[model samples]
Target: MQDILYNLMSTEFENPWKTIRSRPIYDNPWIAVREEDVLKPNGAPGIYGVVSFKNKAIGIVPVDSEGYTYLVGQFRYTLNEYSWEIPEGGGPMNEAPLETAKRELEEETGLHAATWSELGRIHTSNSVTDEEGFLFLATDLTPGPSNPEDTEQLIIKRVSLKDAVAMVMRGEITDSLSIAGLLKAFMIVSSY
Candidate 1:
């Protein structure tokens, strides 16, 4: 099965569309918007707008010995809504993802983990953005003081891993990275 899947993916499929030209539409420290002129798969000419992220998104699910995990609640300006999610932040392109996860966990929840394992990687909003994301499972936690950024007004919560999974099922946690990380963590813990 693995070989079949690998062969399928490794097979080079010719790109269906042809790019005519591209130009920058907007630019910022966090993201850049670009417009591309392309010939569609069906030979129609069209324009495509893509948002490129300057940093990789990192999420961490920090579990204590008691089977509990930490969550962070904050108001998302873009969504204009309050969101509950696992500790997450943008990792600079030059920095390691695990290091960013550790910083985010400590800054948002005041917890530091001695052990870390990668959970998964995802491409968030692949249709419109080039934002890549990574999730980590952190354990052996120790408490410390939180140092959130001035731009962040965050609330911290601790809940059982089971309850976190329930939140995901109930659609209470809509953040993609959080849902993915929590579900993976649940599976990892359940195997123990």
Candidate 2:
């Protein structure tokens, strides 16, 4: 396997935010954004690009003690469709990624884990948007009551490890973050 960071070098960026244009991503009023950004790549200079996002969030593959995985179904305003995603949640503002993961896991799946291992973070379309989402593994879980937001109408469901992977292959679960965590977990679990 090729190392992803084999040739990577980075520097702290400041004042790289410049907006050429921005538009609402959805008609519902709270999600999505068509954003233009000016960034200093490799500390050379500033370049501008535009991209769209359905808001930023943390996604979790909530695993129970029984080795089951939980997913949540909710209507996504940007896609204007319902999706079955990993337990996903976000912050009030400027919240840590781990904090969001813990909160989202409990709210979406009604399950809290005694341990969480952060798989990593993913930025699917980082060219123009300023969003980086974290992915996590939830284990040692105990079930409780879901606490979805007032505007949220969510359904929680569980699938065995085998079935979860099958759902991804069947396009039944397409959320990128969830998919990433599952694939990573699969790589580790299947090796055993």
Candidate 3:
């Protein structure tokens, strides 16, 4: 695995597909859709539809000194199901991801932290979307009143980091960002 990753990182490659034409399919404040006509690497013509996001995504796991972390529960319209995830939201393209993480953490959980560390970065649904996400670990938390956005009706739950990892393993938390963030946090916290 290390060899493969090393080769991948050390190699320089160019895009194999040549774009022949492109057109917009949809547009909104949050997302824009475009369809492109391309010449494939195999020299065949193809069309690809891509969803572009206007903002980067940020997910935060606020862990107090007691090893307790917070989760936000809400109904996800696209999935038509309720999801339990770490405090997450969109950061404007021009904004810093850390600032976005701080704002989202406070807005969704009413928690402020004195220390922050980035867990990892992920691309959510790479095949269909160009949405990028950053995960954070927040410690030394102080709680206040939550100020969720108008579009959000959220339920906040506090759980041990271990329990949160179990929820991810049990498939109770399926959001990609949450699952990845929690699992990474579990590994980092367990080492200490």
Among these predictions, the greatest TM-score belongs to 3
Residue pairs with colliding backbones in model 2 are none
Go through the candidates in order and give each one's C-alpha lDDT: 0.95, 0.73, 0.95
User: lDDT, candidate 3, residue 31?
Assistant: 99
TM-score for each predicted model, relative to the true structure: 0.94, 0.73, 0.96
Clash list (residue pairs), candidate 1:
none
Query: Candidates 2 and 3: which is better by lDDT?
Result: 3
Query: Candidate 2 local accuracy as lDDT?
Result: 0.73
The list of candidate 1 runs beyond 4 A from truth reads 1-10
Candidate 2 runs further than 4 Å off: 1-56
lDDT per residue for candidate 2 within 96-172, as digits (tens), equals 77888888887776788898888887875565555667888878888898788888899878888778888898998
Clashes of each: 0, 0, 0
What TM-score, to 2 decimals, does candidate 3 have?
Answer: 0.96
